[model samples]
Target: MPQTLFDKLWAPHVVADLGDDWALLHVDRVLLHDMSGARALTEVGERGYSLARPDLVFATPDHAVSSAPGRSSATFAGGARPIERLRQRVRETGIRLFDLGQPGHGIVHVMAPELAIVLPGTTLVCGDSHTCTNGGVGALAFGIGASELTHVLATQTLMQRRPRTMRLTFTGTLPPGVTAKDMILAAIGQLGTAGGTGFAVEYAGEAVRALPLEARLTLCNLSIEMGAKMGFCAPDDVTFAYLKGRRFAPTGAAWDAAVAAWRTLRSDDGAVFDREVAIDAGTIAPQITWGTSPEQVAPVTANVPYPAGPADQAALDYIGLAAGQALIGTPVDWVFIGSCTNSRLSDLRDAAAVLRGRKVAPHVTAWVVPGSETVKREAEAEGLHAQFLEAGFEWREPGCALCVCVNGESVPAGKRSVSTSNRNFVGRQGTGARTHLASPAMAAAAALAGAIVDVRSY
Candidate 1:
């Protein structure tokens, strides 16, 4: 069979095929974050339905919580109360939750794979778009709307249409300063936000294999931005090694068996894909968005592109950025690093390397957040926290603070922020907050320079 990775993952879950395109798919894992779970649980209760397999589901408090530096709690002290009530609900339901203040508490995407909850030949769903982030472990992972979330909560199955298969092949080595974030941002810019609609993208070639598992997660995290329902990579040794010691990982003989099964998760030689895209790693520059869409991006060393003839002038005017201005020296009001997309300890270490001895610019309000409680503790033990604070950055507790304005932790409107989070859509960070998405390194560079600047030189 000329099957792609997506085909391999999707075929196993098919329960029945409906005329035209829909099918009933059996879901193996239902992963939901704090806020989305609460909403879905409420909706499920409103309709009087019970979860069929609570044990197969996992919930965590990440998005609405604060991942601020030095914060020991999972639920923020001053944040949304309803969110915590929901985390309690997950626990009350006997759902295994990485609750606030727990060792593994952090972004669900980062936490799931680290615990080995997302393994080969599994189907995972979450309410968050970046659920695709887990695809790095060779699982079929995707996001769903609140309605689909409620359905999954009610009955561990979902009605879905199979997505087309797309293969992205990367060759050569990335430059020293480029990170996974740069690769994904470049992908989004190349394909446009809607490019991968109805497709599942499988990343391959030397460039992908060269990335660390966490970096691969960052690469798959933005698959939704390209309109994919799901995305994944092949399971390999890097995935197994990172998963070996996590709390929920398989142990002893089970671990050996699991690894043995995972070895066959990749596309076989001569396997075919519905679509293919090729990228040369050497030419890709450090990337950042200039406008409302993730696709409206330019190289860090390039200028904000000018739109031709007639276009969304509203977005252009709102950013207060005239056409053709170089992004390298553009001033910024805030800088944020630490989101589900790039909040791992490695991400913190990369940013810290840039700010090690340099002070943050006087006018920049900068913050660093670790993805999980374990990540928070690890970074603190290594003095990454001290370096950031010494640089005049505000060290916050662990939660998804400012990753979005969900918890009132927003950058004040009209202020431009260079962020490490995924989306830069209008009002995504906060209403009217001009968001320029970049890698942790680039965000760190912006914080120190008080503007969007190429991180390579630093």
Candidate 2:
């Protein structure tokens, strides 16, 4: 039987068919963060169950940690509780933890791939919803809830229903400034937020193949926004090269075996997917989210759509946009260029490139947070920080800064901002703050113009 890339990776993980479309899937890696993971671990201890495989689990403090340089657990107001709790849980389970100030410590999604902790043709699970970000490395990664986390903790396996496979092939070449962020946002705009429900998406075709490893990560990071259970790109030389020298990657003869195995992990030529969509890369432009939902997107040059229903009207109201209003020249009070979705070194470099020799508008408060300490170090080494600092953007330490309101970093209420984070739901950045989602370059353009402007204009 011919099989899709998804089938090639997933079928091997199924331990047993439990009927009703469910299967017992063996999970290769389990990642945990401070906020939800601490609680899940506590529940497992309370239930008197031993961890089935503590060596396979990894822990980090990301979500609730302060991204402020010189920050301690105590430096972030009200952050000590979760950090201490995570440390305690990690100690109890005897699992490895990437603690604050350590080189390996970072946003779970970012660290996993950079360290080669997430390998191709494996299953990875995390308590965070954006766990799908790890799927960028060609793993069958997905997010699980608290109860599900407890189950995985106790047994290193999960019960999940098989998902239909969807293939989205991007043809032609992408124009400069039309990034992976733009590509995913454009797909969501055309397909709506719920379009990929009940499906795992396999991104393919010329454009996808041509993407750098980091950009491929950006594409898969937003798969959740399109309602995908997970998303992945088939492994090839680019994938192997990125993983080759990483700490956790297999070495020597083991490396040869791993690469040989990965080469066969792609879909057979005659394989068929349950659903298929094709996108012309040339047609995609720099995208901006107009309403709260990621699907409510428009090209930077386009006007906001006129509301077609009460739901649309409500989204417009919450986001402070009027029907048919233009997004260009719309005033912005803040600009954030960071998140697990787009906070890697390449993302920072792209934003810094736009800010070089240009000052941010006096009224806009702009920030650039690195995704990991390693990325921060690399960017600073390459003088990327100086460009941002000279352009009036704050260069912060790594963590999920300003992406969610949990760490007390927030955009003030009634303010409008351009951000590169994944979600723009109401109150995602802070209470009552209106978020306009865009690529890092687009965010940089907005920071300079003090209003939404096309990056192509810069």
Candidate 3:
């Protein structure tokens, strides 16, 4: 029988088939962060259970850590308790932890791949929906709930239903200034947020195959935004090269063996999917969200959509948008170019290229938070920090700054921010604050103009 990439990665891990599409799938890696990790660990501890495979589990403090310069865990009001609890539990459980000020400290999704904690043909889970980001390296990754986390901790496996498979193939080349962020946003716009429900999506075709590893990571990072269980790109030489010499990646003979096995981790030539969609990458423009949901997106030149239904009208109201209002040139109060979705070095370089020799608008509060300390140091080496500082953008310490609003970082009430973060539910930034999602370049342009102008115009 022909096997898809998902099949190749999922089959070996299936320990039991419990009928009706359910199976017990072995979890190869388990990642936890401070926001939810502490509670889950405490629950298991209170129940008097020990981790089945402590060596396979890892924890980090990201969600509740302050991104303020020279920040301590206590920097954010209400942050210290969860962080301290996580430290105590991780110490008791014996799982490796990447705590604050550590090189491996970052958003769990960002740290997993860069540190090679996730690898090709593995099953990874975190108590984070964006754990799909690790799928970029060909891992089968998903977010599990607290109960499921406890289950994985005790059994090292999850009882799960098999998701139907979908393949979204992208053909043609993306135009300059259009990026992987644009491509995924365009798909969400076209397909609606629930379009990929009940499926695992594999991105393929010429454009996906051609994407650099970083871009591939960005593409997979948004799979959950579209309601998919996970999304992944097949691991090729590009994936192998990116993982080489990483802190946790295999070395020497182990590296050679790993690459050889990864080569066979793709779909067989004749394998079929339950559903498939093809996209013309050339047609995608720099995209931005106009409403609360990620699917309420349009190209930079587009207007806020007039309501097609009551739901659409409700979305417009929540976002403080008037029907048919033009989004381009609309004023924004802030600009943020950081998140687990787009705070990598490549994302920073692209935004910095636009910010060089330019100044931010006087009224716009702009910030750039790197995804990890390692990414921050590397960007500094390349002088990207100077470019942002000279342009009046606050360069923040690496963490989930302004993305999840968990650590006292937030947009002021009633202010609209153009942000590179994923998700823009009403008050996602703060009470009464509105968020407009965009690529790093688009966010940078908004910072410069104090308005949502087209990045191409810059």
Candidate 4:
């Protein structure tokens, strides 16, 4: 009778068992963005289907909006149509949209948590893969395809196969300069990208519990890179503290009641998982992706690995790195610090600590884009933005800048960039661009050194 955290969150939302390990699960929260939300909404409207719960759906314009200062929806010509269409569709559907320049507007994943639109024990779905980022607060969140987005919009429910449960427990103490980004990166390198296929992973153990809520979100944001659609950490005091007094979170007596119920959102002691993996926190160092895949990673002190096969060789060729080459001292042309993966206020603080009195190298173009307007305002309030600008980093407006490269921001072709974004896939930042994934601090260090260097040394 024991239930895992995923089971506890999932069972209550089951509207029906659709058989074949699939179920019709009620969706408590739905997020939409300009890139796909407009199309999905248009589809539903054309079909004459009404939204089952328009109030539960929140839309934003992160994907197609420019992050440049004084930017407007029209700033990115390629994305202007989708932004306009999303604005029009949301008006027709009566869905609440956090429009550009609005207080609540931001990247769907970032603003959702910042505004407390996602909460413990809820089921959230977004059109983007990093929707799993909301799971840090204990939500059963996942991404949906175009059809699935329309289905959820029409019925406020989705048909999904049950995923096996896996627990990744981080034991021991995190080494100096190690971070949640490093922790997850090390796990992916150890287990490979396909390690968590068909499973919903729950992060636990000492190190995971000790992570700040924002860091926990960063940890969960990369779950998709490991082939898992869903990942989460159980609700604890840390989770509760993070949600208190937020815009969408409960208030007064309702807040007290919500906390009481949320306390039971953990897995039962006797609960069984399909698989469990233990990672030593002490063994993990600052991690950087060496190749196209998130799994192609090594510690900052490590060298480019010898190719194990053609796949490895091909990755090396694409990244323009030779086997046995040292990752340290590799020339970096650009440094970007932002993304749903690591763009919260705390992430900015981490990078600022490294760039406080240092200037960026003359040849390295560096940028620091906050994840949301709220984060941008808060960082500015604390003077973090000034420090970055003083250190030769561009203080960019928020919206996935340089991460997806769809909003008029990208590393130029053939440039090498040290980025804090989640994935380092070929051309992820721009055509023929090579991306090295690292923590915000690591990216800052690269910006200062004009090359990949160990953050601990910086």
Candidate 5:
């Protein structure tokens, strides 16, 4: 009996089959953020519903917090109203909260794996789409809507259908400047934004195996953009090693038991996937988005996509960009390299690799916000913080910061920012602000040149 990793994971969590693309699925973990708690709790109050597995639920306020370095003021347009409301909701529900300034405070996705709350073979649910980020740890994790989140909060079971499976396999080695971010962006570009709809994607091959834990998260984090409901990697020695000493991981005899359990979580030899996409790491370069959709991407030295197939005419016009024109050397107003997608400690190190001894272009406003205080501390200890500052980039505190514009942080209107954060939808960074998503290393190169320079040559 051959089973794909997706099938192996999906089988354990299935509760019932309910025709019409829905199945009763059991949840192993429920992650929530400040904004989501407000709506979910208010719904719980209105509907008189109670949490199914209250002990497994946790809350944090990272999404809307100010990443203003050492600034205490949570100043945004709402001025902490959202934060207070979320705090009130979490308190009312009696759920454990990492809170704003706590050691575990950070993007829900980044914080989960670091705490070891996301173990192999578990099913994790959250209100944020990037929850797929946890799939790096061999878990089935992804975002749900507010309504679905409320349902999960009250009922640890979800009405979800098993998705089709897609396996992304890559062999050989990645070229320098090419990263998991680029690999994922390339996957999304190849499949287009709608490629993974109603599917769970498992990454395999020599390239995927070579990636570090943080890099795998970057690959899985964007599964949503490809329209996948879940993304995961199979558990292996590398996975066990990465989890063995994490904050919330098992200890002593329990730790031994946990490791034993994790060791068995791999695809059966005959496992099957509904679909698969194979890529070569050598073919992938540092990728960057040229338009609103994550699918509108190209290699660093490549030109913007022309009207291929059916494309967004308006989006192509909005940036005032044309097909076949190179993005390299195009002047950029800002460069941001922080987000759940690329704000981890390793991400900073990668950026610092390119930023060392090189100054940011005078015309570019550069910012680097660590994903968590833990990441911040580690970066500073390693002097990566000093490297960023010396390169003229703002070495700021940890939080969602400009990634969500949930805080006061925002790019001025009409400014084009080369950001490492996920999603470059229209005005996603701010009102009328334009964003281009790329890997952190590519971001550092762009910051140095103050434009969209191809990193293949950097």
Candidate 6:
């Protein structure tokens, strides 16, 4: 029988059929973060349950830890309690907790892939919506609620209904300054936020395959914003090359065997999908979200669109923008270049390239937080941090930072920001903060210009 990539990844993980498309699916990897890990671990202990597969569980403190340079767990007063509790529970349960300043410490989604903990053709779940970010490695990954986290800890399986399949193929080459961020944002703009509801999307075609592994992660990170729980790219040579020497990845003969098996993880010819969408990569430009939702986006050269309904009007009102106003030259007060979505080494390099021989505008406060401690070290080794610091951007430690807005970093109320993070929803960065989502290069350009500007022009 012909099967899609999702079908191949889903079938082998099914432990039992639970009727009506629901099944007991064995989970291959479990990631826990500071925001919810402590509570979930406490609940499991309260219920007198032991971790079914402690070896498969990895915990990290990212959401609640400060990203401030030289920050400790106590640096963020609001996060101190959660960080301490997470440390305690992990100690008791023997789950590996990548503590603050640790080499593997980072946003859960970022470090997991960086460490090769979430591999191709595995099932992973984290207590984070952006857990879908791991799907870049072709894993069947998704976010789970609090209860589901507890359940997964007590038993290495989850009760889940199989999602229908959707294939989004991006044909043609991307134009200069267009990126994976723009590609995904363009898809969401064309398909709307709810277009992928109830479907697991597979991103394929020339453009997707051309993206580097880190770029693919950025592409899949926004899957949740498009109303999909899971999105993935089939593993190919690019995937294999990226994983070949990473820690936790198979080594020696095992690696050869793993690659041999991974090669067969793609969709079989003639396989059918529940839905299919094709996008021309050449048509996508550097995109920025004009309103609250990811779908409320336009090319950087475009203007704020006229409202089609009350919802559109409300978004514009919240963002403090008028219909038909040009996005370019709009004043920006903050620029953030970090998040699980876009804080990798490559993202830093991209931003640094734009800031080289330039300076951030005096009115713009810019920050560059690496995705992980490893990324931080690598970037510094390459003098990327020097470029950003010389250009007037704060070079901070690795963590969620302003993307989650609870880690002692935030854009002030009513201020406009150009951010590389996934979402631009109201209050996502802080109460009443207005965020325009873009790529790292675009965010850097905004910081230099003190407003939104075309990266291409820079």
Q: Which has the greatest lDDT?
A: 6
Better of 3 and 5 by TM-score: 3
Total backbone collisions for each predicted model: 13, 0, 0, 0, 4, 0
* lDDT (tens digit, per residue) of candidate 5 on 300-371: 888877776445666776566777888897788899999899999999999999965999999899999998
Off by over 4 Å in 4: none
- Quote the positional error of residue 353 for candidate 2 in Å: 0.7
Ten-residue stretch with the least lDDT total in model 6: 348-357
Judged by lDDT against the true structure, how good is candidate 2? Answer: 0.91
C-alpha lDDT values of all predictions: 0.83, 0.91, 0.91, 0.93, 0.85, 0.94
Tens-digit lDDT string for candidate 2 (47-86): 9888889989988888887888788877786779988998
Candidate 2, residue 204: the lDDT equals 93
Which 10-residue span in candidate 4 carries the lowest summed lDDT? 99-108
Q: Can you give the TM-score per candidate against the true fold?
A: 0.95, 0.98, 0.98, 0.99, 0.96, 0.99
Instruction: State model 1's lDDT.
Output: 0.83
Candidate 4 lDDT by residue in tens digits, 15-37:
99999989999999999998889
After superposition on all C-alphas, the RMSD of every candidate to the true structure, in Å, is 2.1, 1.0, 1.0, 0.8, 1.7, 0.8
Please identify which of the two predictions, 1 or 5, would achieve the higher lDDT against the true structure.
5
Candidate 3 backbone collisions, by pair: none
- The alpha-carbon lDDT assigned to residue 234 of candidate 1 equals 91
